[model samples]
Target chain A: MDELLRPLVPQVLGVLVRRGADLATAEDAVQDALVEAVRRWPDGFPEDPKGWLVTVAWRKLVDAHRSEASRRTREVRVLHDVAQGPVEQRDDTLQLLFWCCHPALTSASAVALTLRAVGGLTTRQIAEAYLVPEATMAQRISRAKRTVSEHGVGADGDLGAVLRVLYLVFNEGYTGEVDLAAEAIRLTRLLARLSPEPEVGGLLALMLLHHARRPARRDADGMLVPLGRQDRSLWGTSLIAEGVDVLQTALAQDRLGEYQAQAAIAALHCDARSADETDWPQVLEWYDELLRINPSPVVALNRAVAVGEVDGARAGLAALASVPDDVPRRAAVAAWLHERAGEPATAAELYAHAASSAANLAERHHLLREAARLAPDAPGT
Target chain B: MAKFLLLKHYRGGPQQRPNARTPMEEWTPAEIAAHLRFMEDMADDLRRRGEWVGGEALAPEGAFVRYDGEGRPPVTDGPFAETKDLIAGWMMIDVESLERAHETAAYLSSAPGPGGRPLEEWIEVRPFLEYTPPVVD
Candidate 1:
């Protein structure tokens, strides 16, 4: 029952908002409707759960408005008329997503609000996922809602904010009880269904392609397994196939965005039978396209790594010259390229430096091991 | 955000800075109270900022126990008279960045010491290993 009702949350909230309810009020009404559904659905499931939720939530909104004397100025009659009309089965989730990811809200606030309103996650769950206090997350959600109401719903044409928030959630990696990567993928899949935008498809494919490698990303003791060393058999073939199909379809649309280009690069990696067999030239071309679209230092750093794989280690080091020194993985990439170039001592020192500054424990451990392996007096040596 | 354990050592860590190694017992009572107060206030501030997960100061004395092989009872050893390294306390925090964790550790390291001066103790900032699988990307 919960699974059936989860996807309807955004739709119900969207209907209420379209019927003149404020964003906060609509969300509240939808939450109330959800609670009511939970209490009543055990006996039987409704044939039209989405419609039932929309109607019930709309009534709840009207009732709340009628009871609030201060808000009596709002035309309850117009709201009722709008609610009584034929229920348009239009996808309101996309509009609700746009509202939740409104530019007025900070990225953190946007992520929290989207998780709550669109992803059907509780405030406490979201807080736990973020490792912050429940009250802090609650305040953040309310503040985001207030900001969205003040700014009005953002234009639906741009899904950049929504995609960025989803990407952030995906990158948050697993920590708390919530599987945020899976949640992001789920939300992206839903967004792809609602919006035919090539970028939406691109984002979905990117997540799928990344997620396909989850099984081989960690070793038995929970240590990071770099892409080159991961067990190829553990990769999810079905997800890879689906991702490749999605990326191909999005590419056919002729609208190349950063996400599409990134997915294309990911698809190329996924298609490789082994690290040695990976088509670095094609991968580098995709990175070139990505850099052209979004000239971020992180992308530049990644491009340098790809360049190293395609060209000689010297060419890769030359590529690194274009990237800023302060990028998080700059030293680590340099270490890798230096090692490839037969400069083990320099590689070891850089690896040690990178390990000290690594934010993630697993990554830090991996870098330290790399340093140890490269050191002159290492045990095996 | 990431969770980090800022460990304050009783006896082990980087070499103490020159002119900064005064023992706690030798400090004035007022200075000791001020140091304790600073530690408490730091915890309070972290809680207020919603960054603190937990904190604890361990007793100076502790015993080491090991299980006996087979069906035998466990063997217990006395708290050693001296040890090279002893953990004093730890504060766990969930923060936005590694830099923020370092900043918090630095702040905690500034607890008042002998003559009401900053201790400047080295606080080891270690990230908690997340049990969850990493995202492949």
Candidate 2:
């Protein structure tokens, strides 16, 4: 609930971990300290919240360790000395993020731990966002922390993994109690600031550019409005401008990554006044750059769509041949291509088939409608 | 109160509705979005009525496995071979009466399909064998 508190979580955690606190123990103490803050901080603000959290969490860590290991006067003396003195909080947020997103953990586990330690989201909030039971999420986080503690992602953890985890968070969308997309943007903004990596800026730009269209992404009844149909008037100009600015800055660095390339495509879409007015040639070019950076079936599938717009529907259909049928939504893309190619009958059949295997109700219904539109009785429901 | 499982099938159902005989793929993107919204709206409505239990849409791919032996491992087969049934997904609901359950199933079956027309797909409703509350001591 408190925006400021969540960011400080990883900052203070970095301090505790730096002082030789066990990763799991330090995380637990940090969480406890956060709980204490929620109850007491409203009464009166601490002179320095980060410092307060660090001190409290350190004390908890010391207590836990004291209970586990016999009190060596030497260790206790060292702990007491550190506790008594002024606590200094440094920006260990980036390092903590890298460690939390340890390569040893599965992406799901990495996401859970990162949201807790680096993103400062409560376990309950994270669980709610993921649509999993709180206890299940707790197990996931703790297990991830265990894996992290064992593997020990030494100084300067994997940046790629960190970015990937952040990307996954952003893509999880506005689900349940957490606006994970917003939270992702916030974290990426911090990473961009702390690390100064072009990819970090690229990621932030990509998020902002996509998020800028949030208002027009849905219709009055909360139905998803596809990009082509979305009202460009409802798009957030400020966010788009900020995203473009960030993207340009990143591009100027002379380093092109998937995020930057992807952001460029998003930027092109944002630049359009109308769907028909979109610069398809530029979009297709960017898709080429994206393919060069990250050549996957998903990218190939998307590139096929861009090909349709730039090279004509027939060419798009030809390009579609390269994408494996097993890839999700391949049939849908084929149906759209056929529709564009003026084969309404073929498109309708394809749409009907795709609907049967549609991933969700929305997709299924939409495909069904497309079939009906092209069927012999076009007017019938 | 009783609980019922409402099953949706991808390949097999009790005779398909003529209009919805078409698959979901042919629907326009807007139609798909509208159809999904309809399902979610139904869920939300059920929740408001205190009849919602749980629901999920399954991915298209699946396999049926039969346990073999400890060392041999399990044998696996496609979700359907000769068997025409290929379950797509399902919804579970708790209702005040069997009639309510049927009504809920009917409501789900009425979700908009192609041409903004009601799907009118037949829902196979089966009540839960046990109704034990999952409360722990």
Candidate 3:
């Protein structure tokens, strides 16, 4: 039932917005319609759920305007704007995405609006996922809608910002009761359908590739498992195949964006039969291309790790030196390099330091385990 | 998101700030009331932001207890740690980033002490380890 309504949330909201209802009011109207549907739809699913929602939401918007606009004689035209929306249901979903990710809004505001309008999530759900107050999230979404409405423009929303917001949603993974990563993938898939840009396909492919590896990311006991140590058979073959197909199609377009480059790297890893069988040289080439595409410190650090895999530990360490020390996981990478360089004591010490500074419990525990493993191997033990 | 524990110490920090020079007992009752009100207000503000998880003030005294055998408990007296022996209290907050955690901790540190002055105390911020599986490793 939820899957049925998810796509319609944005379409209905878009309809209301197109009818000259303010974006924020349109969102609230959609929300009210959703609540009414929750109450009424259990008896029987609406024949046209989108149409039902659009009518309900549009009525709500009209009622709201009547109560507020009774003071203004000119606002009496609200009735005339009543859309024959159910019959004229041209998909306005892509425009809604553009509206939510409008350049006038901040990234945080855009993210909140995108989640509520496109992802069909409640304000409370997004708040819980983001660890913010429900009121704060509500304010952010409303403010974002108003910002976009006031700065109303054509379909010129920065797709890059939309991609970033989607990536952030994916990175948040499952939080509270929301499977944000799955939602992000779903929304990206919709975007890919709407847009002809290869990067959109590339983003969808990248998400699929990473999501496919999620099953192997942790052991039965919920312990963090490094990619090399993960059981290869656990990887989702269908998702991998889908991701590879998407990546190949995107790459064929010949405009290499950051996401396509990243997907290519992920494909390289997925193609390998085993850890030892990985094509490190080819992986290194993608990293270099990624560096050219997006030269971030994190990327540099990741590239250094690849350098270590392709070359020797000493060469890896040299490459790592160029990466800023403040980057997260720098110590962990150094520890790995030192361990492979036959310096157990240095590795163990670095691992311990890395564990102390680790951002999350799993990574801290993993780093501590690495440290403990090397502690006995070192001369002191 | 990260959860951080901001530690307020009874007898800690490398050096005491100027506002903390006078003990709470020596301050006037009005000053003490004002300080407590500041704390309540701060906690209330955090609760409004949905960041405040919990906080509690501790009694001054404690003892180290250990298991002797299977059932017997042996307690040690007059042997407190040379450092961080007395924690006054702590506030737990869940925030978006390390920077937010630090900002919250700084706000807690600015709670009024004796003479209605900001303590500017050193509040220790420790992150709670998250148990969620990584999306990207």
**lDDT, each prediction:** 0.85, 0.83, 0.83
Could you say which candidate leads in lDDT?
Answer: 1
Error of 2 at A117 (Å): 0.2
DockQ of 2: 0.02
Residue-level lDDT tens digits of model 1 in A100-135: 888877677788899999988878888888877786
- TM-score of chain A, model 3? 0.95
lDDT of 2 by residue, B1-137 (tens): 45689998887767888856888998888888989999999887766444566789998788889989888978998866566887788998756577988988888888888888999988889876432211100
Query: Which runs of model 3 end up more than 4 angstroms from their true locations?
Result: A63-87, A102-109, A131-155, A377-381, B1-3, B23-85, B92-97, B111-116
Against the hidden reference, what TM-scores do the models get?
0.77, 0.73, 0.87
The CA-based lDDT of model 1 is what? 0.85
After superposition, the stretches of candidate 1 with alpha carbons farther than 4 Å from their true spots are A59-86, A154-157, B1-134
lDDT by residue for model 3 (A1-381), tens: 678777889888877776777777888889888888988999988888888888888778777877887776456464545575344666778888887888777666777789999878888888888775676567667766778878885867778878888887788788578888999999999999888899998999999999999989988987789988989899999999999999999999999999999898889888998999989999999999999999999999999989999999999999999988889999999999999999998999999999999878889988998899899654556
Residue pairs that clash (backbone atoms under 3 angstroms), model 1: none
**Candidate order, lDDT descending:** 1, 3, 2
DockQ of each: 0.21, 0.02, 0.31
Please give the range of 10 consecutive residues that has the lowest summed lDDT in model 1 chain B: B128-137
Tens-place lDDT per residue, model 2, A291-381, is: 8888999899999999999989999999999999988778888999998998988998999998787645556666787788899778752
C-alpha positional error of residue A31 in candidate 1 after TM-score superposition, expressed in Å = 2.1
